[model samples]
Target: MNDIGGSDTIKPAAEAGRVTLPEQGLWKNLGQADGLESAAQAWTPLMFGQLDCAEAVCVFLVDPEGGRLRATSHWPRTRMPAGALIGAAEAAMENNRGVVRGGVGDGGQLTGGLVSVATPLVVDGIVLGAVGAEILPQDQTDLRVEMRRLQWGAAWMRDVLRRDASMADKRRYSNAIEALNSVVNVAEQKDIATATRSATTALATRFDCDRVTIGFQRFFRTRVSAISHSAQFNKQMNLVRLLGAAMDEAIDQRGVVIWPETQSDDPRATHRHQKLAQAQAVGHIMTTPLYSRGHFIGAVTFERPTDQPFSQDEIEILEAVSTVLAPVLDEKRRNDRWLLSKLGESLGGHFIRLAGPGYLGRKALLVCVAALTAFFWFTMGEDRIAADAVVEGAVQRTIAASADGFIAESFARAGDVVSKDAVLVRLDDRELTLERLRLLTELQRGQIEYDRALAARDRAETQVRRSQIDQIEAQINLIDKQIERTELVSPYEGIITSGDLSQSIGAAVARGEALLTVTPIDAYRVTLRVDERRIADVVEGQTGTLVVTSLPDTSFPFAVRKITPVAEYADGATSFRVEAELTDGFDNILPGMEGVGKIDVTEARLIAIWTRPMVDWMRLWAWRWLSLD
Candidate 1:
C-alpha cells in the first residue's frame, strides 16, 4: 500500500467470497455504458458484487459544467449510503488520493466492525471524483484487500470523466477562437465609429442578442457611440441616455455587470442597469467594461430575450472579444481625430491626471512651479541695472611737496581727519634757514655801509649801498616764502583719502609731488562701472541705492550725476563709468569703499528684471550666428 492520506493506497485482495471477473469482461461492460453517469451506475454495482462482505457502494462524479462533486450512483438502490461512506468519498476527492477507514461507524467513531474505503478517480493530475464502499470485513487483512479492489476499480471512472472534460474544453476553445475572429474582422475598419458599429452588430448576431450598444468614456463620463442594427440615432434620446448610464455603472465598478444576477456573482451597484433594462423592456442584459493598458476606456452592453440568459461560456467568450477589441478601438478613435483635436485631447488627459488625486510629490512640484511663473508674469518690480560701485569724493584735493628736500616731519597720513591749514607733510627746512641767515647778515653790512656814506655826505657811495641793502632784503623775503612752502597742509577741513608720509620720513621728496589726498568729510560720491550692455538704461538724475562693502548693512540713496562716454575694458569685459552723488546717509561713508550699486531705470515685470542678462546674451548670440537670409 502507498501513503493513504494524499496518495494511492492498496492491499492484497482477500481470498474468501471474492468473485473474480476477467479484466476483458470488466472493460467491455464499462465501455457499453453511454456516458459518465451510466458507466458509474453500472460499475458501482459490479464492484460491490465482486467484493465480499460489502454493505454498500457509491460513486461520485465531478460535474464538468459546474466543477462540483455529486453522487452519480449507489448500490442497493433502496437506501442512501451510510454517512461514513460518503465522508470517505469526499475526503478522497479533496485529498486527491485513496483513503481507508477501519472500525468506523456512521458517526465517524471507531466503535463498529465495519471498514470504509475510498479511491479518487484522477486523470492528468485532476481529481474527477471518488468511489467509496462500506464493507463488513472479516479482519484487517480483509479490509486491506477491499481497499486494493476499490483502488483498481476507480480507473474506469477516471477514463469516463477525462473524456467528458476533454470534449467540453474543445468546444469552449473553438467558441473562443471564433469570437476572436469576429472581433478582429470588425477591427479592420479605419475609423472608430465604423469599427464600433460593426463590432456591436457582429456581436448581436453571433450571440443572439436583441440589441448591442457601445459607449466610451469621455471627460469622465460615458457616451454611447454606436448601436447595433442602426447607422445613426439621436444621442439625446431617453433610451440612449439610459444605455450610457448603464455603461457608466459598469465602468465605475470596473467589472462586468449582469441583470438578474446569479447567486455566485459578487454584489455590485447596478441601479442604472436595472433602470435601463426596465425602460427598454429587455429581460436579459449584460454589460462588460473595456480596458486598455490597464486603464478603463469604455463598455459594451448586450441585451437578449427573457428566456435566454447568457451562459458562462458565452460570457467568457465575450470578455475575450472585449480584450482584443479595446486597444484596437481606442487606437482607431485617436487616429480619427484632427491634429489640433488630438493635441487638445492629449493635453486634456494629462491635465486630468495631474489635477486628480494621487502623485502627491509631483503635484506639489507643479504647484510650486506654477506659483513662481505666475509671480513673474503678473508682478511688477523696479527695473534696476546692477553694477560694481566704489565710494569716492565729490572734490578731491592732493597735497603735494612744495620744495625739493628730504621729508623731515609728518603730521597726518591716509584716513586721518584734519582741519584747514593742518600740516600733512614737512620737507627738510635747514637749507632755507641757512640761506635766510646769510641774506640777513649781508643786509646788515650793507645797511651799515649806507649809514657811513650818508654821514660823509658822499651821494654816489650812499646810493650804491642803499641798492645793495634792498637786494639783500628782497633775497631774505624770498627765502622766508620758500621755508613756508616746505610744510604741506590740508587745503580744507576733510579726511586724508590717500598717501602716507609718516612711514616715509627722511625719504626724498620733490616739488609738487603728491604726498596726501584730502576730501571734505561730508561730501561723497559713488562711481559705478556699469556694463556696456546696460549703460543705455542709465542716465543722469536716475535715483538708485548703493551698498558699500565697509557699511553693507546701510544703503545710501544716490542720483546719477553723469555717465562717461568712454568705455573701459577690464578682466575680459567692457563697462562704462557712471558717476552718482549721494543724496543722504553719508555718515560712516568713506571714499574708496567698494560694493554693488543698482540704478533704477523704470518699472517693469519681475521676469524681465531677473532674466534680462540671459535674454540679452541669447539675442546677441542669435544675431551673430543665426542670422536669416
Candidate 2:
C-alpha cells in the first residue's frame, strides 16, 4: 500500500533491513501516462523478492488525490483472491493502521496462516495505500520490521508523483511570464493608435483567440478603437455593437465578464456575455475591464471557440495585463491630440452629450448643483459680513488712584463683578493722615495767635492771623478729601475687565493712574475685528449672529453699531474693529469673551455671497501691487 496525501493511512516508519531502492532496478518499464501500472508491476516484485518468509504479497497503490486505489501486482504468482486483497488494503486506509483480517476464502498459495496482514505504505505523511500479505506467528513476528520495508518501497513512488506535479507547474508559470512580457512589449508603443492595434493583435495571437476588440469610454458609452485582424470595420455593424455592449458591461461593473460563466456565482456578472458570443457565432467570450486610478477607462474582449474556453489562469493574466495597459493607453490618448482642441471639443460636445442617452444619473446631479448655485447667487441670500469680534462692554469705566500713593489693599481683580461704589483698591493714606494732623495743629496755633492779636487790639496782627487760619483750614480740608479718595471705588455696576490691583499691592501709583477697569453688564458690545478688505461692505446698521468658543453651539444676534476707522494688527493680519450691539442676549456671553460675528449688510446672490471675500481680497492685492509699482 502507498499514499501521496495528508490523510489517515499509517503511522511512522519502523526499523527494517535495507531493501533495494526503486531507482536501482525497479520501475524498469514504467511510464507516467499509464497511471503507474507498469511501474507498480515492475516495483512490487522487487519489493516482495527482498522480504523473507512471506507467504504471499500484494501491493495496493492509492492515487495521489486519495480518491481511487488499484491492486498493482501480487507476488508468489497467486497470493489471494483479488477481492480479499482490495478489502484488506481499504481497511488499512480507513483505519490508518496495519490490520489483520480473515481472507475472502478464494485464497491461492497462502498456507502460512489463516489471517492476512495489511501494512500501510505511506511517504511524506500522505496515506498512499497498504501492502497485504499472508504470514504466520512464526513466519514474521516482528511487525515493525515488515512495515519499514513497505515504507522503503513507497518512498520511490512518492518521488515520481512529486516530480510529475512540479513539471506541470513549471510549464504553467513559464507561459504566464511569456504572456506578461508580450503585454509589456505592446505597452512600449509610442503612438496610441499604433499601440491599440499592436496590443489587440499581440493579445489575440498570444492567447489563441479567434478575435479581440479594444474599446474606450466615449463620454458615457464604449467606443470601439481596434479589432484584431481587421483594418477597416463598420462602427454600426451588429457584431461591433454587440462587442461594444459586452465591453461596456465589463467596464461598468469594474470586473471581467466571461461568457458561459457556467461555473460562477458572482452577483456582478451578467448573461449578456453569452448573448454576445452566441450572436457573433463564437464559442466563448471574455471581457476584461481596464482601469486608471480606479475608474474604468476601457476594456478588451476576447473571443474563442467552445473547445478552447478561457481558463481562470488566462483571465487572471489578462487582468494583470490590463493594469499595465490602462495608464499607458490613457496617456497616449491625451497626447494624440492638442490640449486646446480637446478643451474646445469638450466645451461644444457637452450639451450634445447631456441630451444623449446614458449618464442620466450624473446629469441629474449636475442639474441639481447648477440649480442650487443659481438659487443662492440670484434668488437673494442674506448678505452677511463675517468678522472676528472681541466681546466688550458698551460703556466701560476706569477706577484710578487719586494721589501718588502705594497700594495698601486690592479689593477687586479682573473678571470680578462688582456694583457701583464697590471698593476696588485701597492706597496707603499714612502721609495724608500726617499732613491733616500738621494742618490741624497749625490751625490751632493760628486761632491762638488771632485771639492774642484781638486781646492786644493790634489791627495788623489780627488781619495776618485770620489769613493764616483760613489757609490752614483749606489745607486740612484738601487732605481729608485725598484720604477719602485713597480707597478706589468702582463708578458703575460692571465686571473688572483689567487692572488687577493685587499685582499693584505696595506699588506706588501716580495721581489719575487707573487702578482697574469696570464695564457695565447691561451694555454689551462685540468689537468685530473685520478684515480691512471687507470693511466697505460693513455699515453702521447691519445685523448678524455671533458664536464664541466658550458657547459654540449657541448663537447671539447682534446689530452693527459702529465701524472703527482705525486698523489694528491681529494674528499677523491687518483688521478693523466693527462694534455691534446684541439684539437678543444669551447666557455665557460676557465682556472680553472674544467671538465670531457676521453682519447682514444686504441681500446678495449666493455666488456673490461666497465669492465676495475672494473678490475683495483680489482687489486689495491688485491695488497694493499697483501702488507699489
Best by lDDT: 1
How do the residues 1-629 of candidate 1 rate in per-residue lDDT, one tens digit apiece? Answer: 11111211122256654444344554566787777877876676567666876877889877779987788887756548777777888889888878877685566444445677899888888777889988887666777788888888777677787887787898778677976786677668878889989998988998899999999999889999999999999989999999999999999998999887777647888799889888988998899998986788999999998999999878888887787788888888877888998676546534523645659798899999899979998999989888999988899998888778999999988889999998788789999999999888888888889999999999889878987988888888888999988877888999988988778889998778888889999888899999999998887999999998878789999999999999999989999999999998788888899999999999998988898989888668654544311
Tell me how many clashing residue pairs each candidate has: 0, 13
> What TM-score, over all chains together, does every model reach?
0.43, 0.39
- Please provide, for model 2 over 491-599, each residue's C-alpha lDDT reduced to its tens digit, 9 standing for 90 to 100: 8888888887676679989988877888987788888888877788888877789998888889999888887899999689999888888888655688778777877
**Superposition TM-score, candidate 2 onto the true structure:** 0.39
Report how far off residue 589 is in candidate 1 (Å).
65
